[model samples]
Target chain A: MEEESQIPKGRYAADISSINEAHARIKSLILKTPVLSSTSLNAISGRQLYFKCESFQKGGAFKFRGACNAVFSLNDEDASKGVITHSSGNHAAALALAAKLRGIPAYIVIPKNAPTCKIENVKRYGGQVIWSEANMRSREETANKVWQETGAIFIHPYNDGRILSGQGTISLELLEQAPQLDTLVVPISGGGLISGVALAAKSINPAIRILAAEPKGADDAAQFKAAGRIITLPETNTIADGLRAFLGDFTWPVVRDLVDDIITVEDSEIVKAMQLCYEILKIVVEPSGAIGLAAVLSESFQKNPAWKDCKHIGIVVSGGNVDMAVLWDSLNK
Target chain B: MEEESQIPKGRYAADISSINEAHARIKSLILKTPVLSSTSLNAISGRQLYFKCESFQKGGAFKFRGACNAVFSLNDEDASKGVITHSSGNHAAALALAAKLRGIPAYIVIPKNAPTCKIENVKRYGGQVIWSEANMRSREETANKVWQETGAIFIHPYNDGRILSGQGTISLELLEQAPQLDTLVVPISGGGLISGVALAAKSINPAIRILAAEPKGADDAAQFKAAGRIITLPETNTIADGLRAFLGDFTWPVVRDLVDDIITVEDSEIVKAMQLCYEILKIVVEPSGAIGLAAVLSESFQKNPAWKDCKHIGIVVSGGNVDMAVLWDSLNK
Candidate 1:
């Protein structure tokens, strides 16, 4: 909690120094995934594209960075008590692996509707699972109950200073890898990845344009950007399971202030982008991870007057935790 | 024919100097693909695994290296006459793209039974197609007819000196990337890739063990390794379409002296390995490309006591021109 006081207020909510510290802190724990580009993909979009493949990150996503920071930042006393989070995605696996590295317990609250494979992944990583009914309210209530009983730290998926700052470390690596990048396209779910990247990239080079790619079904972030208010979808129907969640409190501010624009893409575009990734780049990109490229190829993005000069683009492939059922459905449908 | 004088003769037929020249010639043309690794894959095999991802290579395979060398090595007179080859796979696309880079026309003789997608790829790269009946004899006849009619220089897929030297350049990149590698795994089709890699790797470090992976159905190389002579299979059947070709004369001598062993894996094993590659490594590995990793996981390889000491291993992912029909069928079957 003492670290909370050190967090900056207003425009500079996340410290660039804190991101640097997080990079050093989790240096040995995570992989610095390769920045890949393709000749065919570049030719199609008429842009020099660079893909930061975080799908190859530890725990199959960039969540490992933030999760590791949360787990390792805890003092011995807090670490002894352990940490808890309600997640059915890469975050659960990330937190589990991160806690296991520190020899601490990780409590994961997974909804009953989550796939059996995801639950098994959390268990395999040494997480204690508490099952709840399928719904946000149920998931939060169960997680709250666990916290009340054990006094474990609640590691939010996106809405935490430590978590957001840790995820921001990606930009530090990306900027160094491709210093000439003019625009960066990121897929936004609960907005942790984009928030972290935007803050770090802007601090490094304020001229760099930060854009968010969102699924049309879950275009809360896009709607928020245009209307200057949050818009929660009653239901999300996109094939990108990882992008279903809306923006969180801690992430929304960074995204709103630092991010240049939000571009929405349909599920068809995501599948097409994924097909290109496999066909051209020889990489398996889950739907959410593929959205960055989807946005780049979209009519809205390509025709945007503001983005015409964005010849050098960086795309963030956020995760590779593929929901196979969704993939089959998307492909067939 | 004057260029043929530069090719060394005797037991050590392919000169190291020739490979060095090829490396210098194609340095700017080809990509130095990264050697990737996985923690979970390493844990499963109990060895540090490094993957040379030629799947990400231009034209989606390592064949581009050889083709680029052959196309670029031609003198102005030869270049003006253009080039021709008989291939219905990655080689045609590779050769077509390579010739296009040098402003020379590439003629491809494809069997009538070849897939429409493959023909489209050749055309996409500006290859002029001459159809032949579905057999090796017809393919050769068509290519010879085209060559005689047009005086186009013939580029043998695996047998040529320049191509082998160009393919060997991968070894220079891999060895420089991971100097401590104790074993190198390569998937064998016509043996061009393995022969080049073995020669280059051994030249860099004599102690490095070079092993070949082959499909059981198309196991000419593996059979040759065991029998001390080439045993061309009368009929080949395998899901690894790129690995169906028999060994060529120029590559066999290099393979016989340099390669340590050949490991054969089943189509089932190749598919499972591909699934693991996509699930764990987040990379799309075609059936042919995944065979190297599959060999390491094979029962015989695991039981062999001689291989116990081999800790750090490098696996060449040969190509990523995946057959989607094959992939879908494999998954469903």
Candidate 2:
């Protein structure tokens, strides 16, 4: 665990006002994804569970909401040169599509090891791809080099204020659909999704518990929160590629302060949740998107006192862009 | 070919008016399922196509629309005693749920060989199940016995006018959503769905070409249309379990008169279409549900002069409640 004093000052500074403004700005541009009741999950947990299906969102993920908000929020002068971002998959495809909609060029720095399907998705959406080595340093260096050369603004995948504010729209929509939610369980990677959701949800009803569901293999958020400071994992590994990020500087403090708990679930739990979603719900949820349900189904959550009497629970199903081959392998395992 | 003079009277008597009334009666009960465009299929076919996703409907098939309509069309006295139907799968589950919603008891007659998953679905939705031999005679006899014992109204799976009307709702919704649709392709089983869809679509716009898609293995509808009479095969054999039915008395005439052509797709084509739906559309579709798409994608339709200049095409994707084990094996094949 890292020291508490190492925490950043501005990370937890976001409030409801900014999130509301973000909602207003991006509401027209993004899809108001449906919030569906999970009868099976609810029955199993003995709790009324509502899933905010961001998996059905444009670009097949919640990242589009943030990417769109960020790209559109930029001023005319800043937008002309376009935006640059580094992502292994979802974020790059999302940012590319969002930028294209705004008639702006997008420079996406992708790792060489990125999935072929994701790479094809990025290219299909008209994003310029700049391939880089599969390492944080190489990705950062490539993004910076592109930004410096082309005067394009660097859109950090999770650390950006605009991105967080955009992602907050999901909570706003969820609360609107299911106003009686007692708790919100969100999967945390760089904490962008949870930070935005927590800020918006907590601001609306501070009593609503905000919990983070993390993969046990990628438990940076859990470690960071326990240490009361940001703690970057030296290496990350998980089937849930979307939730394998080391906690971002801007997101760690927000997650540390606002999120009530960080629950970790095994990769197998995620696989099981994915199977359930596919078989019972008839919805294609990627492994990362199933993390919240996995966490709830995990023994840890069943034993947690906070979940004992929760009347209404809201879970964000973040994305559904999964490779069929990988999914088949995971299910067989 | 069978002689035209030998055709059954009921098979030649159906028209568009009955289908219209059915659509109006059941409009409130059934969902206007979304029509989604598949970028992958469009690229492959070089023809702009839209999939009417009945797979997302209640009970996981368009069968629910017909089932609900048929159940609710019952008189107050008949409804009070409850309803009974014989189906190996989708229809049983659909009728069970629809009857449950209307506060009526539902009796399902299933073959002992029916998939366990489907049997559980009927029970899950509050239907009493009665097992019968895996043959049409046993199923009908069991249903009749249940009706006789309980005074329950018998809702024929596909033979009744009310059921046909209910299935016609899909065409009504599809035409309303895509007004420019030049051609409509629908799968044929006992011909209830196609008969209804043809009536609704042709009535609304006589210029629109209506086609029936059938599996080659269970090409009873195709044979009937070709013969200008109803024809029952010696034995039914097909992977498209839903399409393995002889045209019913009420449905035969509606399809024979209204449907311009009956296109037969191979079982392999249906499997491939199902796989494409799962992989590209991110929706689970049973082999039978994909027959319409298979017809459009197969060599028969692709090389047809009628399809050469077609701008808009609509294919009814009937259901998604597939046995995952069967799907896994089929996918491997």
DockQ of every candidate: 0.44, 0.22
Regions of candidate 1 where Cα sits further than 4 Å from its true position? A1-13, A115-117, A323-333, B1-9, B115-117, B325-333
lDDT of 1 by residue, B73-99 (tens): 899999999999998788899999999
Worst 10 residues of 1 chain B by lDDT: B1-10
Best by DockQ: 1
Predicted candidate 2 versus true structure: per-residue lDDT over A100-171, tens digit per residue: 999999999999998776787789889999999998899999999999899998888898888888899888
lDDT of 1 by residue, A1-333 (tens): 332343344445466777888899998999998899987789999899999999999888899999998899899999998999999788998999999999989999999877555576688789999998989999999999999999998899888878877899999999999999999999999988888888778777778999999999998998888877676558887878789899877777777777899999988888888878877888887788899999999999999899999999999998886645433333233
- TM-score of every model versus the real structure: 0.94, 0.83
Give the per-residue lDDT of model 2 (tens digit) for B1-333: 122223332443334555567767777777778787755588888788989988878777889988998888888998999999899988999999999989999999999988676787898889999999999899989889998899999888888878877887787788889998999988888888887787667667777888889988888888888889965468877888888878888888777777888899887788778766765566667778888888888898989997787668998998877777633333233
Estimate the lDDT of model 1. Answer: 0.85
Model 1 Cα shift for residue B136 (angstroms): 0.6
Quality of candidate 1's docking, in CAPRI categories?
A: acceptable
